[model samples]
Target: MSTVHIKPVPVTPAEVIAVARESARVAIDPEAREAMARSRAFIDDIEREGRPVYGVSTGFGALANTFVAPERRAELQHALIRSHAAGVGDPMPKEVVRAMMLLRLRSLALGRSGVRPEVADALAALLNADVTPWVPRHGSLGASGDLAPLAHCAMVLLGEGWVLADDGSRSEAAPVLDAAGLSPITLSSKEGLALINGTDGMLGMLLLAVADLRHLLVMADVCAALSNEAMLGSDRPFQPELHEIRPQPGQALSAANIHLMLQDSEVMDSHRNDLAHAVQDAYSMRCAPQVAGAARDVLAYAETTAARELLSVVDNPVVLADGRVESTGNFHGAPLGYAADFLAIAAADVGSISERRVDRLLDVTRNRGLPAFLSPDPGVNSGLMIAQYTAAGVVAENRRLAAPASVDSVPTSGMQEDHVSMGWAAGCKLRTVLDNLGTLLAVELLSSVQGLQLRQPLIPSPAARAAIAAVAPIAGKPGPDQFLAPVIEQVRHLVQGPALRAEIEAAVGPLR
Candidate 1:
């Protein structure tokens, strides 16, 4: 239960992952209070002086032309929250909600959002209390922030929405606030706008996707190595000297990892000097690093995008240090949208390549001397034949999901938001891509493990053996496949889980 302290600066994507996955407690830096106080004072001054600031003394979006009275400003803020909390779907996973809240707190703490310091503190308190607001999965267009999704979060702070308890039950925010020894503060001028107008939801999901892809990519290399050995594919292409000339960091790293995984193998030694050996392995086996490495490079770009976003203040009409409120397009989710779409493409390509390797292992002509579908009885037992079909289906879905969501836009709010990012949609789709990648790799793990077993006594490298051990508990040893669906699911679980990567890294000296 370590605390992640939030200062008036950008947090790293790694920190976001820690909060999302580890449930890390959050603390606001004391210095940020000054900025928060100044923003509040600025908002108060402008409101008292009858200044026509958007979302403060004026209506939102298409109604920005209309002026709001001082007496109704509070009610205006209340109504804005009520109207914008329009998300409709299953509640977002708790981790995503917590990450969104943490990011919003950091943004407000920057003193750029013109919100009270309590708004930031209350956010941290809710996260620390583990009372995650039930944010819906849809309704955001990724313009004017993640509006609909974030507004659901804002609703809880006003005690007008639902809170998901730590135990997974949904309860009214009012009682949840009471049980947490807290009370919801009434919204101040522009506070509702401040809460909902950010890219936290999409950005948080992007950060999580980045972390997941990193692990899955490394695990992908392990799959390639196992496939290479099982298919008796040569490792010469993975030699350091071959990749060194090109100097692509991710490519070189993947090559080096595969080389390590294929080392010290009796299977390789058996065919090392054979004169009749195939001149080259299939592209799926030989060009694994190239395909997987290309994906890795794209992930590097996505990381850069996530890093830039994690520390941004994505609100409309951000209040500056000189106490001036200026409207800006910072709330547009275009940058995050592009990043998310790119990651989806990369995930699909990598998963598609791994699926190819699985097919190679199941094909008698390509699998060297292994039985068809790695089945002991061939036609008598279906073995992992359908598993390849499952992987193919997932890969196809990923391909469809890879179409960039950022490029599509529809007008909303009386055409005030004419070009929406659809970044939220991109995030949602990338999550599905990542998940399919895991299942796709699990199919490879299942088939490749069987291939390694069928190779008999020609032990794979220590790295491959360690990886096998990590996955064997769930993937199990070769036998008449019992309920292949559950086995694939379990293997998919282990692929997404830490066990396989941990053991392989422990043996192969980290798959970086």
Candidate 2:
């Protein structure tokens, strides 16, 4: 139970995820009131002239050039939502919907989309009230601004689409809106275009991925410390001077984090002998800083793109302060779409490296003196062998998903949308990578903890010891193959958390 208050001020995607995850309420910033006033004034001016405006007086897409009868303008808005609600495949998770809603509200909060104030208010209310729309996961090229999926969202605004109501049950959007005493929004001028155009889907994916990446960064340090202890590898490679010469922010951060996690440990110091194992550690161990550092770098790039998107006004026929209507490419999603694919690739690497470590920890040959599969009985039980296999399978799946969706495009509306970012696919796959990465790291954490237990007499680094202690409540050493699933499930719970990492650091003092 938490509350994130957004005071109409612009917020980062990370902040938006925090608010959505916590079920927080949002209010318009008083500062933005001025912008809203100016935008509405421009809209009013356009209405008074009543001449011609794209999406206002005419049709959409293939019919953009056609003149729409004034009497059917409102009908056009509703029809646009219905016709575009072409999403298919599995419904998105409720959390994703919550995230989408938060981002949509944030985008509208910028007050540059020229949306009716009530529409934004309705979105915020849905978020605060926990009324999430049931959005399908597919059917968006991420061009034409996430049209299909967003239409599902907009449909709810018009008292249509499927929704999760107050009772936590699915219901028709119209009945739910009726129950909530809210009326559907009537399309005013370019309002229909404003509702569906933009990169919110991609924004949601990056927001979720960034949050996951932050946790993985901390877990990476913990995993490295554990692997270092388990394999008796030297911590000298993580020295500050080594990273200082290169002066990469992520490298320094990784070195510092690993240093902190391994500080003051008997196991770490014992392994400084530089025992000749292939003259150097495996790439997974030797190159932890490089690999994890690259991920951090990519995440930074994704964050920049996401921030710009959240603050952008992405819609057609953008209203100008002087009442000039301009149809522009503000709705282009290529930037975010590419960022999404790139970030997913980076995140997939996190899982790949983690799975490699898991494999090393399991194999008796490469695992130094640890028992085969970390099992007390080598022949009778094949402990943790299959865990590594599962990890490998997930890693391979993530690699497949990491292929950039932004590189592919298909034409639509007679080539009006010939080039698309496929942004929704990018966001969707990135989210999948986030889930896979979480599970991958969880397995590694579980294996590392079990391996550490095998070295009972010799203690790990102070920070590593603290992390083990925190997760110990959730996971215990496997007695046999009996219900290893329960132990694996705990990996998901403890490793992907800042609180657990903080607790470990508190006990260990500062990581290097």
TM-score of 1: 0.97
Q: Residue by residue across 223-276, what tens digits does model 2's lDDT show?
A: 876776677666778888988898778778887787667667777666666455
lDDT of 1 by residue, 1-512 (tens): 48888888887776777787788888888888888898889999997799898999999999998999999999998899999998887778888888888888888988898988888888888888878898878899999879998888888888879887666667889898889887887888889899889999999999888889999998899899998988898999999999989988889989988998998899888898898889888899999999889889999998888888876778889998898999999989999999999999988999999999998889888788888888888888878899999999999999999999999999999998888999999999999999999999989988888888888777888877886776677766777767888888888888898877888777778778
Model 2 TM-score, all chains together: 0.93
True-structure lDDT of candidate 2? 0.76
Provide the TM-score for each candidate, comma-separated.
0.97, 0.93
Q: Candidate 2: worst 10 consecutive residues by lDDT?
A: 1-10
Backbone steric clashes in candidate 2, count: 5
Over 4 Å off, model 1:
165-169
Best by TM-score: 1
* lDDT, model 1: 0.88
